[model samples]
Target: MSENHTSTASTPSAPRKKHRNLAQGVVADISEQIQNEILKPGDKLPTESEIMRIQGVSRTVVREAISHMQAAKLVETRHGIGTFVLEPPPAQAFGIDPDTVITMRDVLAILELRISLETEAAYLAASRRNEQQLQELRAALDALLNHTPEDGDAISPDVHFHLLIAQTSGNRYFYDILHQLGTNIIPRSRINAAKMTHDDPAAYLERVNHEHEDIFNAILREDPEAARAAMRTHLSNSRERLRRIQESNEIKSSSDNTRQ
Candidate 1:
């Protein structure tokens, strides 16, 4: 009997992985096109049939991939209006961060910027807030009426309170800016506040409540200068606390990465 040797070729199963990969690739391609402004906001995405034709994928795969992007807030689907890009990509939900690299000084600078905007916001809020706005502001404050330092609440209420003030300033632009920046600012401020409160509960609470009361009084009196000043003092304390935090983080990061 003669020895026989056989060589087998790879089967169609190898391409199965490629199919799933191709589906993901299609999703990414669509997302990039939209983000690049090649597909403008409010422009309807191509229909399912059209996408299938363009991507050379089956109907089910195309729909599944598009469904994933919609869930990610990158796109929205209307019953009859078709899929369109959401406006401004929802605050904190999307952005390109060129300035994500942070230094101790940069952190302090952000806090300083907050001081300027918020103080003016308080001043304008005092004289400009209308009945509805006041009601909303009070509602927001009431959400934190008795918040204790130990109680880990008031985060959302605090944010809404500031947003109300910004809106009441009668500058939609200010409101939008605050809405965008607030997402980043509030949590950092809260973390810094928690650290300070943990260190000296009584003093921290006393100072915070007193400054808040002063801001409230200024708003009630409609004294723009006092409102601004009170807000400045409040934000200044916050700025100092964050600066301390940045220094601490720098020290910690330095120690961790130190070579033995």
Candidate 2:
């Protein structure tokens, strides 16, 4: 039995590992082509079947490669059409890495930064927002509230809601700063607060929407003091929520270890 097991283990199981490498190789090759201008922006990539035939890879490998490219923002897929190379955006002067944010302290620090910047933005937006801008702000808030956590499309609207406020401030700098921060401004990017609040995901989202409503109403009222106060409260509450999640996770981990 021992000799039989050794013979089976010694036999090469290279096919599965080779397929995984093929997928990664495809991604690297396509990225290099784009860099060399062989695949220009808006140029369509080969179809999945065509790629599979040409690269001698399985359909699964082709799809995995495409997914990697999309995640890197190097390409986009258009329904009824095909995947196309994308023009890279300009380099940001400063930004945070979402992957590096693993702890509640990191999230709280980001919230603190936002409180300092966005509180003033809300105040300025209250004074400077025009009628059309005010309407847009209301629309953004409505969009946010319209989606539940289950849909997984709630983050975009939430980001837009804050972005509209920055734009309304009449300071292009404020909007640029927030845009540079990208989706990291959304708390969900750093911490999956919705999933962590396992009691009721919909209720969690609704509670957040209520906070947004307060900020929106204050801005609509054109009360700078109220707007500033509301914005500050929203961010402070977010910090507390993340802290609670961190503590809960630690407790659960300890319990599991003790049981083990």
Candidate 3:
């Protein structure tokens, strides 16, 4: 009698993009390009081949990122032509158009959006998240905490942690919009503002992570009210952090002018 033997070796897969920067990472990279005026409105975006080369992500990843940018009104594609940066139309009302988020004030405006949406998301996540998702959230947070300076900022895992919470909310809109905002939603990722403002950036990050812990614990205990409160506190603190940075910069500039 012949017996079938199971293979002990796992099937090998293609090497992942370093750190799995993925579609969101591509969005962030291209968004930064737009923010810095490297690719101005009406300018044609680089071809997929070029984007793939620059971002070290796959062509499919590039396409996915571009789709999100289109959803955000940051870019437009003409079939058989190419994608182009969009000139934002005049705001008909007071609402954020993510493309216009170039200044610190703009960032604060979007952070307000995050505060409103994510607070509710946390409450829902606490009430609805499954055991597997809870484990994923914990894993994402731990990755952020353990991320090394050598691999660059903790933005990837930081974004992942929040994305997981939104995913756990069981509402696709929350996940979709947050994914559309991507890393651009994070102030530190947007401007590296923390490093410039905080006397000790490490300590500041530790404090932020402490707040994350509070939120995580609330969800772990299935305390919806506490989860909402914890999210509010963390996001509110981010706003205050930015305000303080702005004030400190202004004061320093005034001092320099006086000395001169």
Candidate 4:
């Protein structure tokens, strides 16, 4: 025991650095490839294992990157088939990052933008929509009504419903703008306002569907004025609902702090 000695290395140990966020890095690389046209629309993405091996990332990181790309509308997954790149929207299309929208004010501002664009769109669609377009609109509405928000993300059908209206407007610009906004335009995408409206998500979604029906009916009847009014009312109601959610959240936060 008295002769015991410890050995130490002459060189100092190097500090370990944290790894980069592999998912975000993959998203950036893939998005860059798409932007550079290296991965053209309709081109199939590499298999997950291939991507993992090439990028030196885990399967989880690859999946996360794919999810982000889907949310951005850059790619779509086909069941039993590999994921494929989507055709890029026109250069004029407008895009808003979902992360930038963090408050009711932000949501209301976007709704304001929508009201300006869509009230006119509803009027134009009511007057110009053809039989096929009208049928498509109804189908989109039906999809929304049938979808269960509790079961999965309900934003796609809701966004599609509005996109169909924009397309019906016969103005390609309107459709491009909404398409550029993508699924982020759906209120549920940014906030859980549905729960604030009703404890049961189904009831809240049903109410939203009824509002949609009002707009659809107005468009179906070819009443431009009614369509405009209904669209305005629908958007205004959305803003009000989100405002209520903001207030409720504020109250809950206050109560939580008081308890603390």
Candidate 5:
């Protein structure tokens, strides 16, 4: 031990610290460009090599920078495609980080958020959706209907159906929030609560599809009031199912804690 020496310059932590600084430098430059509108919303960021050249950073640093940008919500990276700048959230924008919505309670909170946001969206969609959008909605509906109940992975159609409603609502903010939320908005996708709570998950999903059909028919009829009512009932049914599961969980947790 008396003869041992470890050089800080060669330590792994030293290289990591250097890389973090370089990454932060890249993140700052790109963030400034976005804030200044130099990199506007929907505009794709440069290739990773381009960024490496411009920032004089390593590939690892550039990738780290992009990850930081995404975490800040300044950009969204589409796999196999480039990262694009996102429209900045407004000062009053109500946002929920999808990564944090892990628990059933978190999903229930999201349902409440949807109840307020989507009921109105459904009404607006019914009143204002064009023929093209309506057809798109039909295509989305059929996708949902065709999802084999044997598979529990129904996220794609479920998300598409709700996103179509938001897009059809003629409100960009509605679409923005829902799009930002993405597949995470579907609670069953996240937690598989239906499978846990229902004796027949397939039948539960079938009934869920029927609820979707009701909402679609209301929209097809262009009955705004009916659309709003259908949307409310659909969401309320989900809320009730989740509430039951959550209640059961709470009781079990309380019993376990008491025993402990």
Candidate 6:
């Protein structure tokens, strides 16, 4: 009788790894072109061969790059129609829009919107929060205390704390909207906060902490009006900072225009 021995080595497959920057470059370059209007919405991009030639890269590289752009919703590729630029939908339309513009005015507008929606949200949350919600809020506060920097650094517990409050509000939609806004809100808030209170770290944090304490106290008391007032004060501070930044930027731009 003849017996055959099989080895696992012959069938072993190598783990696949992604190329970190090449694909990123492709996506970023294409997205920038779209945002700059070089590639408008509905404008079809060149074929794979054309891109490979222009980028001086392999077909695999081109494909991988295009895939990233598609995933970011910056472009769409049809089966036989090739890829076309995608229009940026409104904020909160879906996932991150690659074409979204970042400016001081834009940041200020977003802050204003948050002031209106989130104040009402806090009011409702104060009335509706249960013991579990209160516990979550306290936990978030603990995390903030642990993470808040004594000196000026980039660390922020703001996003997670607000997210916790939104979840504790008992409205799934509030959580969803908060999640969507998370990406856009944080950077803007950080900029505004930093610009507003760059003078004194201790003072800034004390003021912010007091605002938080007032809001939490209202929630504990189940006083919707007080909760709303606290949130309004917190967001108003943000808006005031953004206004200063916008004014500064406009002045700088005007000076540059004259110098030119």
**Candidate achieving the largest lDDT:** 5
Q: What are the RMSDs of all candidates, in order? A: 11.6, 13.3, 25.1, 14.2, 12.0, 20.3
Model 6 lDDT tens row, 1-260 = 12323344433432223455666677777888988999999999999999878877678878989888887888889998889988887785444442464666666766776777788788888989999889888777766555444444433466666776677677777777767675555454464365454546556666677777788888889999999999899879867866876787788889999999
* Per-residue alpha-carbon lDDT of candidate 1 for residues 1-260, written as tens digits (9 for 90 to 100): 12332222344566777777877988899889987988877788999899989999998788778788888777888988688776655455333242562555665666676688888889998988667776776666666566776786546666777788888888786677777566665444455465543567546656766777787777777788998999899879877776677777778789989953
What lDDT does the true structure give each of the candidates? 0.73, 0.84, 0.83, 0.84, 0.86, 0.73
Superposed model 2: Cα runs more than 4 Å off: 1-92, 185-191, 256-260
**Residue 124, candidate 3: C-alpha displacement in angstroms:** 0.3
* Clashes by residue pair, model 6: none
- TM per candidate comes to 0.54, 0.59, 0.59, 0.59, 0.62, 0.57
- By summed lDDT, the worst window of 10 consecutive residues in model 6 runs over 1-10
Ranking by TM-score: 5, 4, 2, 3, 6, 1
Error of 5 at 79 (Å): 47
Cα RMSD for candidate 4?
Answer: 14.2
Q: Candidate 3, which segments miss by more than 4 Å at Cα?
A: 1-99, 187-191, 253-260
Model 3, 239: alpha-carbon shift in Å? 1.2
The sequence of per-residue lDDT tens digits that candidate 5 reaches over residues 1-260 is 33344564357788888889999999999999988889899999999999989988889899999999899999999999989999998787666767787778888888888888899999999999999999999999999999876655678788899999999999989988877665655544344766667647678778888999999999999999999999999989988888888898899999999999
Q: Which of 3 and 4 is ahead in TM-score? A: 4
User: Candidate 4: which stretches are off by over 4 Å?
Assistant: 1-93, 185-191, 258-260
Residue lDDT tens for model 3, 40-123: 999999999999999887788899899999999999999999999998767663334566677667677778888999999999
Between prediction 5 and prediction 6, which has the larger lDDT?
5
**What's the CA RMSD of model 6 in angstroms?**
20.3
Number of backbone clashes in candidate 2: 0
Over 1-260, each residue of candidate 2 has an lDDT whose tens digit, in order, gives: 99999888867776768877999999999999999999999999999999999888899999999999999999999989999999987887676777786667777777778888899999999988899999899888888878876576666787888889999999988888776564764546544776675646777777788899999999888999999999999878777777788789789999999999
